[model samples]
Target: MSEPSTYPQPPRRGFVLAVVAAVVLAADVLTKIAVVASLEGEAPVRLLGGAVYLQLVRNPGAAFSMATGMTWVLSLIALSVVVAIIWMAPKLRSIGWAIGLGLVLAGALGNLSDRIFRSPGPMRGHVVDFVSVFAPNGDFFPVFNVADSAIVCGGALIVLLALLGKDYDGRSTKEKAKAGSSEAPAS
Candidate 1:
C-alpha cells in the first residue's frame, strides 16, 4: 500500500487569514468612527504624557498627504489591492504569508470602506486619520490611520518573509523532491 504524498498544496481553507483580516478591518473602521465622533471639535488630546496624540484630520490624498486632489485614484488603487488579495486567498498556506496577506486585505478593505461610504461622494471621500506618533517640531511625521498602519506592517512582514527564504506553500525545494520521489513507482 502507498502512503499519501506529503507535497504541499493549496489549503482547503483560509479561515484563519480571513479572521485576521476581519479583526483588522473591524478595528480600523471602528477606531475611525470613534475618532470622528469624539475628536470632531475638540483639540488634540494628548496621551502617554505627550508621546501620542489623537488629533482628527481628513486626508484626501495618499501617504504624507501627497496628491491631495487625487483621492479617487487612490481609492482605485486600494480597490485593486482588495481584488488581488481575494484572488490569492485560496493558495495561502504558510502562517506568515496568511498574516501578511490578511493585514494587507484588512488595510485595503478598511480604507476602501471609508472611500465608499464616507463624505464628499463615493470613491472620492477622505480617509480619517487620528493617530500621530511623534513630532519633534509638530510637523515631521505624517498622521496615519489604522488601515495605513496595517498595510505598512503587513508589507514589512512580507519582505521579511521573503528575505528569510520562505514561500507561501510552506515547502522547501528538498521536501518537494522527496515528495516527488516518493510518489514515483518502483521497478
Candidate 2:
C-alpha cells in the first residue's frame, strides 16, 4: 500500500467563508431594515440599562463619524475591499482566515451596499448607523452599525494572525523558514 503524503490538502474552507459572509450580510441588512422602520423618528431605545442604545443615524462618513465629507471616497474604498476579499476567497486555506475574511467581506459589502443604494445617490449615500454605546446620539461612543463592528473584529483577527506568523496557506513562519533552510544546496 502507498503511504500517504506528509502534507494533505486543506479541508474545504471556501464554503465556511461564504456562509459566514452571507450570514453576517443578511443579519446586518435585516437589522438595519428593522431599525430604520421602527426607530426612524422615535427616541433612542435604551437597552441593558443604558449600555446600548438604538436609533436611526444616517452617517455620511467613516466610522465614529470621521471624514463626514468623503462619503463617496468611503464607498469606493469599501467596494475595493469587497472585491479584494472575493478575489482572495478561492485561495483561502485556513479556517481562521476564512472566518476573518468572511467577517471583513460581510462588513465591506454591508456598508458598500448602503453607500451605493441608500439615500443621496449612488456611491455617495449615507451608511445606516443605528447603534450607540454609553449614551444616545453617540455621546460617548460614536453611533455605529453591525458592519463597523464586524470590520473591527475581523481586522483585529487578521492582524493577530499575521503577528503570530500564521499564514492563510496553513503554514507558519517557522515552518517556512525550516523548509527554506532544508532546501538550500550545500556550500
Candidate 3:
C-alpha cells in the first residue's frame, strides 16, 4: 500500500482573512473619501449633544497624533506591518487569529495607501481623520477614522485570544497536539 501523506493541507481561513481584509480596507477608504468630500474646509459638525462630533482633520503621525512631523517613519512602520501580516496570513490556521490579523492588515494598508498616494509627497502624505468625542471639560478626543478603529479592535482581539490560550487556529495548542498524537500509527 502507498504511504499516507503527513503534510497538512492549506487552511481555507487565509482566503476568508484576505476577503475580510479587503472589505475593511475598502470601507475605510470609502469612508475617508466621503468625509473629505463632505467636510472639506468646513467646521466641525456637532452630533450627540456635542458628545460626539464629525470634524475633518489630517494627521501626519501615528495613533493619537504621536510622532508628528515623522510621516516617513510612520509610513515605514505601517508598510512593515502590512508585509508582516501578509507573510503570516498563510500560516494562520485559526480563524480568530486570521480575522484579527486581517483587520490589522487592512487598517495598516488603508493608511499606508493614503501616505503613499494622497496629497503632498510620497510617504509624507497626511492621513484623513474624522470622528471625535468630547469630554465634559470641552476637550476633544483625537480624531480617528475607520482604519484606526479596525486596527485597535484587531489588536484587542489578538490579546483576548492569547489570554484565552487559543492557538492561531482557535484550537488550544495542547488539544491539537493530543489529537495529532492520538492519530499517529503505533510503531
Candidate 4:
C-alpha cells in the first residue's frame, strides 16, 4: 500500500447549501406574494381551533415589534448577515454546517428582499409576517413566517453542532484525534 496521503482536502462546494437556500428563498417569496395578494384587507383566518391562524401583518422592526422606528437599521443588519453567510460558504465542508448556513442565508435573503422591494421605501420596507402560532391574545409567540422558522431551526442546528465539537471544515477535533493516545514508542 502506498503511503497515506498527507495533502489536506479542499472544502466541499456547498451544493446542498445552495439547493436548500434556493428552495427556502423561493418558498418565502412565493408565500409572501400570496399572502399580500389575498389577505391584505381580510380578517384573520383561524385554523386548528384557534391554535393556528393566518393573519397578514407588516413588521418594520425586529422581534416583538421592537425598534419600529429603526427599520433602516434592521435592513442593514439583514444585508450584513447575507454578505457574511456568502463569505463563509466557501469554507463550509460539513453537511450540518452547510445546512445551518443555508437556512440562515435563506432567512436573511428572504427578509432582505422584503426590505428592498416591499412598501414604505427601499431598505426601509416592512417584512410580511403571517402564520400565527398559538392564540392571538398577545400571550404567545409572535407571528412569524417560513423564513423566520428556517432561521431559528438553522441557528439551533449550528449551536448543536458546536456543542458536539464539530468543525466547519469537517476535520476531526483535536481532542477527538488524541482520544486514543498511546504513550508508547513503536519498534
Q: What is the number of backbone collisions in each predicted candidate, taken in the order shown?
A: 0, 0, 3, 0
Ranking by TM-score: 2, 4, 1, 3
Task: Name the 10 consecutive residues with the lowest summed lDDT in model 3.
Answer: 1-10
Q: Residues 43-162, candidate 2: write the lDDT tens digits.
A: 999999999999999999998889998988898888889888888888888898889999999999999999899989898889999999989999999999988888998899999999
Indicate the TM-score of model 1: 0.85
Could you tell me how far off, in angstroms, the CA of residue 59 lies in candidate 4 after the best superposition? 0.3
2 versus 4: better lDDT goes to: 2
Best by TM-score: 2
Residue by residue across 1-187, what tens digits does model 1's lDDT show? 4577655465633686799899999999899989998999888888888788888888888878898888888998998998888887787788888899899889989888888888898988888988886652237588889999999999999899877777666755566667678778998
Which structure is stronger by lDDT: 2 or 3? Answer: 2
Highest-scoring model, lDDT: 2
Q: What is the clash count of model 3?
A: 3
Q: Scored by CA lDDT, what does every candidate get? A: 0.83, 0.89, 0.84, 0.83
- Candidate 4 structure lDDT: 0.83
Question: For candidate 3, what is the TM-score?
Answer: 0.84
lDDT of 4 by residue, 35-113 (tens): 9999888988889998988889898887667888798898889888888888888888889989998998999899888
| Higher-ranked by TM-score: 1 or 3 | 1
Q: For model 1, what is the alpha-carbon lDDT of residue 146?
A: 92
Off by over 4 Å in 1: 1-13, 136-138, 173-187
Q: List residue ranges in candidate 2 displaced over 4 A.
A: 1-5
Q: For model 3, what is the C-alpha lDDT against the true structure?
A: 0.84
